[model samples]
Target chain A: MQSKISISNLDFYYGKTQALFDISMEIPERQVVAFIGPSGCGKSTFLRTLNRMNDTIPIARAEGVVKIDGENIYAPGTDVVALRRKVGMVFQKSNPFPKSIFENVAYGIRINGLHKNKADLQERVEKALRDAALLNEVKDRLNSSAFGLSGGQQQRLCIARALAVQPEVILMDEPASALDPIATQKIEELVVELKKQYSIVIVTHNMQQASRVSDKTAFFMLGKLIEFNPTQKMFTNPDERLTEDYITGRFG
Target chain B: MENRLLDQQLDLLRDKILLLGGTTEAALHRAMQSLTERDSELAKKVMDEDRIIDQMELEIDRLSVEILALQKPAAHDLRFVISVAKITPILERIADHAGSIAEAAIKINQEPQLKNYIDMPLMAEIAAEMLRTALDAFTSEDAAVSREVILRDQKIDECYHRVFDELIRIMINNPQAATCAAHLMFVAKHLERIGDYVKDICELNVYLREAAFIKHSPNQ
Candidate 1:
């Protein structure tokens, strides 16, 4: 199977300080990947590099090729806006627009000019909502303001909004941190369903949630990727004592 | 941290298990002493304390459940909690066997003693040593020391067979000892069972450390 994201000897620096240390990993296509570690270990920094989201802030420099489908995303003359269209992100906060629900989802497709007719936009919006599993709950009230939905429903709206672009890779940065347990489970389920069509990388503080939702698990510490292996092996018999200690509640 | 609370509860349970171990070891010695001196009063005291041992077993079980529920333990904690749970049954069986020894002492008090009990005293001494060493392994969390207990049980087993041979000889040499000899035979059997209890503790100790259940008998 082709790797959806292949990062090799990837290094990142902010001014004089480096944040990532010689990190190399492959996220296979259509599989859910989870990055777990103590805070400020650069999993989220690496996630931003996938879509060139870090380029917006000056002095955040990246070296080494971050390939998507065997194409180097960092190569000169690469259209970052087009690359970002294929790689969408959901943040820790839901951040649903103050607009109505239908418009919130419809905004992405309309701005991208992916559809010409109003009917086409409506069909695409409904399909994205359906794919997010938010269609049934929001089907009767698609015009209601998105802020009126509960935190979980609103997050699902954010996910739907990201999916509306029909991106091939979904970047979730602690997507369920602000949600309750039931809503976290819903997001976990959505990630599982979404992995059938999109390659996903989720950075989470939750160890058991990473064990539950991802096909592969990565452990990072002090700006280094300690281990990347199947989730079961990562949880049960991790190679590094530090990784095992962290998962077993012996340390952070 | 709540993990500190979990560790404290486990330590408390360990203390109680050792306390029960000390109690049973003392009771076994007293039961043997009663048999030696033909003291019916001391035998009754050993027998009555079996109820206290039974109550201790239930209390250990209750605390074990609380640790399992509240700690949501994994790995070694899970293994330690499970070992404690399994170790109770062995401890209870040891207490019951000691109680049976006391009953024998009581019964012999009502009748003439058998051939002066040359091997029964030796067997009880060896059996109590095995129990004491097994509890030592549990308290120190030493697998090597526990393995030593395994080796010593072999000596206890040898003593069991020797005691059996001597009892059979006594029964044949003097038919007048037939009733008293039967009780002595059970006493020998109970001492053999105490050896098995030590073996049980060794197995639980290995599991507590490794989360791996190692069977002593390969054929089984």
Candidate 2:
């Protein structure tokens, strides 16, 4: 199901670093919203807060509400684990387990206790791989080790693993940062394809990559969201001078 | 230069400029060729080709304007399109100077080759080099090299005055070569003007560095 996540007065701190201010925005369902900025502008920090991935950090503290599908996942009795199952994540590095590729995908579903039978599990693994456009590459070698796959292949596997859980939201924290150009292109193609079935939020440092892949782009600076708009306007004619200066290789 | 896409587009535009530049360069070439050989037909070709280059300039301009309006480009994309818009017509102006050289060559073709040949071809060569490098600046986005082109225009002007002085001596020395020498002086002036335009583009890149502000003609 397509789900919209709304952030309201979201404030975050990494051991008093104060990574984000009273940031507020609405990310439309089924559209890729790319969080962009300099290295430490809270783009990735804000993305992590969407799925409550920040809670795992020992000193990371947050305030305000981030609601997905009108439900405040941070509210009392809100299951963090269940919320995570719904909002899967892919990291900058492809962290596939040193197991057969089939087990790598089945691991998420089995751990979630969401499937009833072996056939159902198999269908999910195959479907997610197919959706990621990686099924063809590893179809004949389902039992092959995921670690043996290339950087791009492993990243696509991580995405497929996220999809296998049937999550409505997938948060990618610099998913293509570790890959080469051709691999980056494949991941970008996958992100565009994934937009049809899920709401994806990606944190990227590459300005052109954001322009190429995202539907909407949000620029962050000095711990504040400077501007957020359609990708075309954000990259071409951004309203804020600070945003324009930053994107044009000015004082960043 | 390694990127075929950027290089190919730059080359197409470069070829367009040179094709346009060639007409002017040819005008200067044939003007001198005519002065040296007394070929009136070659002089006429330069004048006719100038009008044709002007028409091609207009067509190229319309096409470039259409791309900017329709494509709705972003930062680097915007930079590229805007630079093309500025670069194409500078090439046309250089062609205009070539046409003037043809006009001068026709007059000189009927008379004897004058001592004014000393600085005229040298000035044309300087102008052609400036046009060539200014285009190289556009193709590479090399602001530093563009500045070099901008600086070279002064040298072209200096050469123009030297030609003006030399031709004045020819006009006084031989009354028959006076009209032809006067025509060559204007051709040198036109070449110098083309150099000024290439420098205008060096600064034009600065204006377009942020956003494209298309200048509207008086009526439209």
Candidate 3:
């Protein structure tokens, strides 16, 4: 299994305060790796660093080497736009473009000029929707408003928008945290399906969701990477006691 | 530490399992006492008390399922529930073997004594001791104690072999003592089977403590 992204001696800070300390891990190719911990543990912050999502924070500073496909993403003169195109992100809330379902997915393809013509753009939009497992549900309503769909459908629409760019890696920050059980199940199933084409890194507070959807799990505590192992081993018999305590709901 | 609602439920589950263990251990002891004393009424009492053991197994099964479904325990808590679910049946089977021994005792008491019942009583004592220690290890979650309990099974096996040969020789030599010798042989076999069940319980104990399966492993 080849590693899609590798981080070593990664340290992150918000202004004068350090949030992550000497963090290092590998994200395997085409596999889902989940980051789990309590709130304020820096799992979400660490996830944002993968694609420079934290670059939006004026006071944030990252110092480390983040390599994707053997190229350093943090090197000087690196194209942030190209890096973000290869590493797409879906947020906790579904932020559709207030456009039709078809246009929501076509937005990324149109801006990136990924298609040859109008017909090619339509084909790419349909393919992205199909890959996100939302085509069958909203095929007839492709021209309808994105806000008209259910919460789960909108989240999948965001996923389709990310998929439209054909990223090699996808980062999701609590993707299904706001949804109900049935809707959460749909997202989880979609995640398992999406791993065949793109490596996924998801930061979730839901322990069972991580166990259900991820191939590997990384436990974070107070900005430190406590343990990283196969999901089955982590859930059944984790190597660290802190991981066990957190997963079993015994942590303070 | 903050007290969680799950901790109370887990405590109740632990109490139920310990109660079941105590009841099964007592059943094994009383069944052996009836056999050695030639007390037919005590043997009947032991046989009748098996229903309680059956009901306890059902209760444990229901509680385990509830915990798994509602609470959704993970890691050590999950392993503990699984161990209890597996161990309930083994304990019930041990009690069932004790009932079988009680039935044999009733049949053998109808005739003259066979060879003073020496080795059979010793085997029963060892099996009962192993059951007690296995239950203790389970309650304490001690893997080392579980390993020691597993090693004690060999003593019961050796005693069973000796009782088997002695009973066979007595049956061949004294034709009138054939029925009594046969019943005593079955009692010995029942004790041996109980030993194996105790070993299984100890294996589960080790799993509950260490989160590792030692059963059928060459190193264990």
Q: Pick the candidate with the highest DockQ.
A: 3
Candidate 3 docking class = medium
> Candidates 2 and 3: which is better by lDDT?
3
Name the better of 1 and 3 by lDDT.
3
Interface RMSD of each: 3.7, 7.1, 1.7
Of 1 and 2, which scores higher on DockQ?
Answer: 1
| Candidate 2 residue lDDT tens string, B1-220 | 1233433453555456556545545555665565556677876776777778787687667756665565444555556666667766776766666666667677766776665477766776777677666655665666667656776888988988888888898889888778878877787777778777867776555434544332332321
lDDT of 1 by residue, B34-55 (tens): 8889988999999999999999
Task: Give one digit per residue, the lDDT tens place, for model 3 in A1-252.
Answer: 999999999999999999999998999999999999999999999999999988899999999989999999889998999999999999999999889999999998988999999999989999999999999999999999999999999999999999999999999999999999999999999999999999999999999899999999999999999999999999889999999999988898
The DockQ values of the predictions, listed in order, are: 0.13, 0.11, 0.63
DockQ of 1: 0.13
The segments of candidate 3 whose C-alpha lies over 4 angstroms from its true place after superposition are B1-3
CAPRI verdict (incorrect, acceptable, medium, high) for model 1: incorrect
Candidates 1 and 2 compared: the better one by lDDT is 1
The CA lDDT at A99 in model 1 is 95
Off by over 4 Å in 1: A1-8, A24-34, A49-52, A64-88, A99-133, A160-171, A188-201, A207-217, A226-252, B1-14, B24-40, B54-93, B100-130, B147-197, B215-220
